[model samples]
Target: MDELTEFIQSNPDPRELKRALAVQMVLQEYTYFAIRDVLQVSVGFISKWKQAYEIQGVAGLALEHQGSVGYLDNEQRQAVIDWLKAKNYWNLNELQQHLEAVYDVVFASKQSYYELFSAAGISWKKTQKRNPKADPQAVERKKQEITDWLEQHRHQISSGELVVFFQDECHLLWGDLCGYVWGKTSERIEVPMSNERQKQTYYGAFNILSHKFFVQAFEQGNSEFTIAFLQALLAECPESRIALIWDGASYHRSQAVKDYLASVNQGLQESEWRITCIRFAPNDPRQNPVEDIWLQAKRFIREFYHLCQSFSTVKWLFEFVTHRQTFNFPKASMYGLFS
Candidate 1:
């Protein structure tokens, strides 16, 4: 019985795992009504799989196999493969239904269908992001512009007169902590989240020279908060000028921010401004290195989710790692090499 439970837990195929688990529960004296409530399967469904296992062992769980006596012939398998090739998408259930409907055949194992997918040159995969809004030419042009700007100001940066910072904001939701976790294969892993939407807004900056990350929590992102955060950043480094590179959020480019910049660098030229704000290309988040800083912080939350039961705990966890911590990633030096 222990071996059966272990087998059910170790099984990778979800369908087979369900069938095996249902049978295992029955043998363990779990009532049919209880199994029905737990597994969401009717009593008849449970009895069918249970009886099939009793008669044909593990092979009984499978819908069908190729050939007459539990296997399909060469021609029949080829037809199935061709049928699979005709579809742009594939899933185990769809394939099973197709085989059961067209040829009245069922493979004793899911591996048989995987073989069919392989023959059709179809491999299981997840979809990747393709950002249509990102303009390649604009991104390249901006990268070169940034490279030129950094090279031109190399002396000030080297002399510690100017500090370079990539700035961004993140909305950290309590729900973000609910991510993939390992548990017993037969059992479901549940996260205890009181309010999934409980969230905090943060302003963060990544220092290029030091690889250090700085962050501060804010009620929300707006013109007032943006300027206030900038003021806080200046207060931290009173002697050095700040070269702030960030995305073009509405607040970042608001009239209030412009007035704030103008007021600080009233008489100085653009090159000598106390705060030199550079905007990354529109809709291109890949240009900002601070993204990795936020990603790392979120990953930390996901890793230690059990510790972050409350919203206050989430904020503490974020600050504990992010405040003045140095983070060096490949994207940090995408525009210009820090070294």
Candidate 2:
């Protein structure tokens, strides 16, 4: 520890002094937070040099680029960029680890890492989703079918005698309190929950014609709940027949749900049925506009993670974002029925 202090005062290169100070701070029992604040370095930087000093003594704190302008040469930088380009997924920590292990280099600032990411044609952002089971052909065909079906109901919809709703279900848990936020890199962002497994199910619906969204919290998304949701939706628009569009969940098509719908439309012809359920393409959720509504509600709640400490608050936030709102998104009108 004394040797480290002497080395720090020996007027060595600024980079070497910074590294020695990190090792000395840890040995002097400085809190990681305090050390980071004073040194303007990450906790990883402190621990990395501390570990190096423990393994190789004061010599371990020496910087590879002590007199050099940059940590990596032009050729090495290209190699790092090439390695990053080879990966399908990436994160800052993974890249940092790679530089430390493969190139035996560590930058004092994150800007260097960000530069690498930028050079590799990458940036921190949300990931795109694609389902392997989704058939492009089936999706196109379903889109056409739904378009023709909506066109067929143009009269009823225009006359206000028929209401169309895109419906979906979401199971929210207590642990779903996370969302992307600007946060400290060295500090882990965590949401506290009493019971992470505590969950609630919600049946959601959106009307393309009216642009109105509706949601009901249910105990579970079983056949009974599905029927109840349908009954409630029918009651809301008492005079109009409801054309329900949703994904093909098994409970939605269960014999019990079928029997309920049959009873509701007992004497009417197929076209005149009081409640008609139309399913989106099997195993494909992207086609259902209601899926967007569900995701939006969840994202909205997650964004207010600090406020939603309890499940009840989460539920309130969920409904607050969804209920009585008009949803407008590009993919939402992909079926061209919203217009």
Candidate 3:
């Protein structure tokens, strides 16, 4: 008897019998069309069974379709899933180490572990930075404080007398921001990298109500530079009282900045146009809308980095790009602050 007929007689499974019958017909020199006509099966079905049998032998004709056995059994897989759920982050190397340590099983290759994770419905992704010392309670309280402050100054804000701004600093590098791009299949697309290692430091603020953006490039970000930028921002908004909200950077909290703020606030109070400085909760860059603005700016710069040659050119291009772009502050505003 042929392999298919022998398998069917030995197995006695209905599904196996069906698959064996199809393979048997094919082995008997029956064309796919003839097999379909005789067995009342589709040509595709007959072809699939024939192909499976030819490639995988009688095992492929088994009634149940069990995928290749994994390194971990069902119980071990469940255990792995439970372990993953308990942890915040894990790399493939760490997972391999854990499997070797706990289960006494070692994955021969990274691909084996990757396949295991994938089969377990786990995916690799970028991890967000979270400060371990950041207090959730303090973050919530700060959010409420900001919300209350906005509510208190609703009239001044609505009348355009007082303006609120979220400010932050970012360092823009002179290298190509490497990311996925459309290219011909199986062909590598290269982005030119700059030999210049120079970077541009920028201080930017986003107007809360007007969706206005104010930015200044500096050689470095420190107390002196921050003070100068604040002075320029204040000068730009001569008509209105400004409420500047920024992160708790060391330069922002320096003695020089304090003295400058004291002098500026004293002068503004005298002139009836106040410039109030408020600090966002520590380690909470997410609370500042200006962070999103910087991210958008860097993304644009990276996408078009090949166009610029020098740091000066990059700076000019950055200013030109950012100056024309109007940020949607309301869309990027934090939950309790602008809601």
Candidate 4:
């Protein structure tokens, strides 16, 4: 039988409990019969340990204790409050010591400390602010304006006239980000490993209409890089003119970009090559289709790959996506992004 299945048959939390029992039995030099005879537990429990041993080898028998009691009584709780007042902060063990010293109270284990703090509505969570680039009102306005433009020009933008490029900066990093991997569906896990390595940001541009992709590697995306990327992108799609859609970033709207746009528009021999700008309303990344694409890319990377330990991991991830998958949900992509 499969180890997991055997473990499942042996213990409720088959993998963990079976291993725990097996290790305890080994460490204590107790046989299954001896354990059952002494502890007066069921033979099934012993069988679970034996099954866990067979499945995981010795490592399967690791013990993890779940503490029984929740918290200290009212007196000990008040003592904790007093300590908090005096010290401003205390680690679980420190608080445990203080409880024992001041209130003569003792908790069964460290997990119980969490239970106590939870009951008291105290927790340590670091709040992260969103990227401080764009303004919210401007983003909303940009989204609405873009949606209106899309609605109005729906007929004009066939497979030929409208080439929408979703462009953005992607960061590389080390190790798997916790939530992304834990949240992944099994289909995501089945993706083959990527060969690329090294930490670098790639300026990615995606054409929503054509499902074509362009990438430019950069240490970062400043005004100069953006201009160069745009020039390269212009070179790639020499046939159909692309309306440059970007956020109202300092870099994107820099004097350098304005100068480049002026030069490009001036040199446009045909009406199609004439560069028109669609600036996302300030802070509203959703107005730009590239934002969603980048987010989905990041999310996909974060969901799989235990090797996602550095920015290089993030870079490798983008390369994997670009090479492996074609764009899907173009309309929904536009809607969700521009919504």
Model 4 whole-model lDDT (C-alpha atoms): 0.60
For residues 135-160, could you state the per-residue lDDT of candidate 2 as single tens digits?
A: 89998898899989988888888778
Give candidate 3's TM-score: 0.64
Please, what is the TM-score per model?
0.71, 0.73, 0.64, 0.52
**Alpha-carbon lDDT, every model:** 0.82, 0.83, 0.73, 0.60
* Stretches of candidate 1 exceeding 4 Å from the true structure: 1-90, 95-131
The global Cα lDDT (0 to 1) of model 1 is 0.82
lDDT of 1 by residue, 202-285 (tens): 999988778888899898999999999999989987999999989999999999999998999999997778899998888878
Candidates 1 and 4 compared by lDDT, better number: 1
TM-score of 2: 0.73
**Which digits, one per residue and each the tens of the lDDT, describe model 4 over residues 1-339?**
244445445655333553454446644678767765664444565565566567776444544344433356787676566556566554675565444333434465667677666665677664545658757776666667877866665544554565666666665543323343343455554323343343466677766555656667877768898888888877776776777666566888899988988888786664455556776666545565555566676678666656654455566666777632456655436533421
Better of 1 and 3 by TM-score: 1
1-339 in candidate 3: lDDT tens per residue?
366666777856554576688888788888888876676556666777778788889887664433332267879977887787677766775675466435545555678777767766678765668888788889889988987888888778778788788788888877635454566889886655555466788888877776778888898999999999988887887888888888889999999998887877774453354678888789867778777777676677667756755666667777876753577655455533431
- For model 2, state the Cα shift of residue 179 in Å: 2.7
Sorted by TM-score, highest first, which candidate order results? Answer: 2, 1, 3, 4
RMSD of 4: 16.2
**Cα error of candidate 4 at position 164, Å:** 1.4
Measured by C-alpha RMSD in angstroms, how accurate is candidate 1?
10.8
